[model samples]
Target: MARIAFILLCHKNPDAIIRQAEQLTAAGDCIAVHFDASADAADYNAILNGLQDNPNVTFAKKRVKCGWGEWSLVQATLNAVEAAVEAFPHASHFYMVSGDCMPIKSAGFAHQFLDAHDCDFIESYDFFDSNWIKTGFREERLIYRHFFNERTQKRRFYWGLALQQRLGLRRKIPEDLQIMIGSQWWCLRRRTIEALLDFVQERRDVMRFFQRTWIPDETFFQTLVRHLVPGREIECRTLTFLMFTDYGMPVTFYNDHYDLLLGQDALFARKISVEASQLHERLGGLYASDQMEFEISNEGRTLFQFLTGRGRVGRRFAQRFWEQETTLGRNRELMIIACKKWHVAKRLVAGIRDHTNVPAVEYLFNEEDAALPDLGGIETTLEKRSRHRRALMRMIFDHFESDRLIICLDPSSLDLMSDFFADRATVRLLEISCSFDDDYLAGHARRVGLAGPQTGADTMARLLPTIRHDMVYERDMMRDADFPNMTRISDTGSVDANAHAIAQFLGVSLETGKTLAETPHLFVD
Candidate 1:
């Protein structure tokens, strides 16, 4: 499948944004989105919650303070473009669209359309002839100083205009660059975008001049397309259809406009309102998913349509980022349970993740472990009981599920095996033991970023296994640690030998499963 990177700029209505993202996305396709800096916290979190299922979607880490009809809009769009480029290395074609935009055709059709074309699809026309800025008035865009804070900046605009009218104080457009204007949207090839990004980086003087220009985004990419990549294929038409009024603002599409939109040969349609339920239903009915997404369509359309009307956001199902990210389901191959022995537990979890990366959870049983719930000042016995042990079990059951080897570090956790076995959290619960060298001290562990203030007896690692473990790893003094794991691993071949023992205990060969093959990487500093 061809990789396409989608950069979507959104301010409100995360439901519509989520719908648009899901429809445009498939395997190997990535979506990069930038929410307006002033966007509501709940709405922003809703967007993240909605897209949590899609690993391909990435948000800009640095948000741009967007201002409408000013340079900040372009800045936010540029940030989204840069983020997409950084995140999706496989993406070759880049599509920049708006949050209100929706795919009118199948994803395959859009993919095939881009695959058939070799050049970028950015449309532009000479600003002098387009009449978008009234021919002779086109120069007003470059000469005027448009302030980003639109409300209070109105007086500044008028004052600047008066100053220019009286004293010719307006800024001059660069002599080397020609201004162009068109539909402020495009689908471009990767090389063209990278070149454009590099051009902006090299020519900040041009950006500084344009930052004060009226609606710079209107002229920014359009001018660059003409100046930087001349003689390239220009479509001169946007993929999104928008009907405009005499005043030059886009008219809202209603149910009546659905037929017209369906007949048009475009990939997307913009500014659809949720109040027009029939329109959304018709659109979803036409472009549904492969697995018969009528239900998804109905749910998404219902929520989107309702939200579009009042701008109230809702997801039928939602969870916090970590909760949604690490939720477990059985019918898998391996499950990791890391309790109090955080040192060995951390390493073993890393080893399993490196080998298979199957579903796993690293539960810290030690009250000393930072992951454990806080036990701050409980006066009553019930309160004390609820704070430490009860909360941990509740958390464990909530995140627990697996079909493979369960590596539990704390023996106290093994006492709750009946709780897990009842839920079938795993097909089989394996007892694993960890033993560190006697020479190892708590101070040594502290130097390596582990928790401090211990007498270094370290009986927990050796004693936990004897109670219930079926396999024990006699981890010799640490030496060969993975760079990601951040421990110096031994070069004396003890790790390989320990891996061999693990394989032997499991009744599997070192050559049979990737588990042993991947063991060294966990400690291969």
Candidate 2:
């Protein structure tokens, strides 16, 4: 059996670490905990005490002080790996994960997956064009820290001055030259870990140069691996969750929008704080066994469809159909609105009525006498397009209730809705475009004064009608173009016109199980 190692850097929050460690231990994997020496000894002792029952867990010597944006943390991790290698020489592979990370897949499944891949799974990417400016700042900060070290601060300054004189230089050296980043956590083969350790020990000058660098955690492993095993089978991306943030600081798991992350097929998630209880509960029992058939739920599928560029109309149609046909009725209350368009809102109301058949109250903006609950309203100038849309959406989302469907007529209304609800919000955006086309093609456009000569001309020349006529003519032409084969026409008429047209042209179902009227306007332009 392949062996895996769980290396965690614990400072505070020992409970989370212990819980994770216990889960890993239950799967028959070895656990190694490395506490930062700078952390309180009482905390460390508490962590050790909790792990006393676990036979695989062990403590390492050579404690190091880990500072943010410094090389010390990576050094400490390397030291722990060294210890694990010494103790488990016969082990096949070693996986590195953080205390904050939780496995979405079972250990047996994860082990088998890793065993199949020969490459190291560390995320390494060129930082020059990416959003890695903070990495450069951290590097400069580390240089300053090293230059001003208390004991050798003056000696280092004089040595730098002497070196500058020897090189005939007057100005200070430029610091922000080259920077690269790799994820701090990774899983490596036992031989790979030994190779990295040997490389570090042999290349003292390189290690010393990196020691005074900022955010060395991002570069240390990358530089070593890239030099040692250039062009080897290494995964450029980490199997981790994409973090959501505000002002460069982690905010939440983006759980309110779990659909966004679920589509990515990531192997792990990180920095999920304790408040993401709903996300935790939803993800629980996701991949509990190796033999378990992994299938996304209907809700998961609907969310993925939206994420992959299917607009709100498609999502609502799929969701309503799914709910009626499947056991996903329990989560029907989750509502997500992408934008607030007045017409879209009306369709949303219509869709809700069609699916649930519930008696829903309607309120118009100008209807002062309409009996309705007090929902907040927002006003924005037409000149401020983005702001106007944002404000309208916010107001609509604020008034939205899971039990009651909120219809927004304006696409601009989705702007604010996106902010309040996560990717998982059950709120579906109704396609106003589809409804508009349906109304216009079915002669309702003239009543709304939107149908001009140009509108009628455009619909008459559309592809759906042309294709439908072409198919009919082709069948007749094949049968000698006479009225003798009129029986085939009856058979074709029994076939769903919309379904046949959509299948022949678009290769998808136009009908949503609950049929809408057969109108040319409902077809995509």
C-alpha TM-scores of all predictions = 0.52, 0.52
332: Cα error in model 1, Å: 96
After best superposition, candidate 2 residue 357: deviation in angstroms? 48
lDDT of 1 by residue, 193-249 (tens): 899999999998999998888777888988887787755566666767665544556
Against the reference, the lDDT scores of all candidates come to 0.58, 0.50
Compose the digit string of candidate 2's lDDT tens values, residues 126-151: 55556655522432433442433323
Which segments of model 2 are wrong by more than 4 Å? Answer: 127-131, 134-179, 254-264, 275-291, 296-433, 436-525
Model 1, C-alpha of 320: deviation from truth (Å): 68
